[model samples]
Target: MKVFTYSEARQKLSTVLDLARSEEVIIKRRGGEVFKVMFKKATPSSPFDVPGVKTNATTKDILDAVHDSRARKLGI
Candidate 1:
């Protein structure tokens, strides 16, 4: 963990953020107000991130459905 004054944090914002990626950063104001910075855990990407019509449809089935809908809309 690292501690920095408010002015230091403002001047070295980028460095503070880079360090925060690995550890916690504490900022202390002149009037004793303090804050901490930390990184949130990243979420892993998934192919099924879409929301709607939850079915056991395969990828090909979904693609075909989308194509058919678009064709209808375009009068093709």
Candidate 2:
């Protein structure tokens, strides 16, 4: 962990960011306000990142069922 004053952090923003990636970087203000900088891990993007549905219905089966229900409701 490292500590830097607000002005020091502002002057060495790049170094502070690099240090933050590996460890904690704290910045203190003249008025006694303190802040910590840390890196956030990003989630990997996926096409199949959907909620789970417990059903055995296929896509075509679902479409056919919808069409049948609509036709029956319309009496056609």
Candidate 3:
């Protein structure tokens, strides 16, 4: 863990963040306030990736339903 005064942290903000990646970082204020820095790693995923809904419909059934809907919409 590393502790730095507010002024020191401001001067070495980059270093403070780098150290926070692997450990804890604390910043102290003259008025007796303290703050902790944490690095939150985000997980990578595709925007199209999502949980699927369980249904009894098959691929062919879904296609047929779409075609029927379009045909009605176009007055075909």
Cα lDDT computed for each candidate against the true fold? 0.93, 0.95, 0.96
lDDT of predicted model 1? 0.93
Q: Judge candidate 2 at residue 28 and give its lDDT.
A: 99
Model 2 TM: 0.56
Better of 1 and 3 by TM-score: 3
Worst 10 residues of 1 by lDDT: 42-51
- Cα lDDT of model 2 by residue, 1-76, tens digit: 9999999999999999999999999999999999999988766578777668899999999999999999999999
Tell me the spans in candidate 1 whose CA falls farther than 4 Å from its real position.
42-76
Q: Best by TM-score, which number? A: 3
Task: Score residue 22 of candidate 1 by CA lDDT.
Answer: 95
Better of 1 and 2 by lDDT: 2
TM-score of 1: 0.54
Better of 2 and 3 by TM-score: 3
Tens digit of per-residue lDDT, candidate 3, span 1-76: 9999999999999999999999999999999999999998765598876678999999999999999999999999
* Residue 8 lDDT in candidate 1: 100
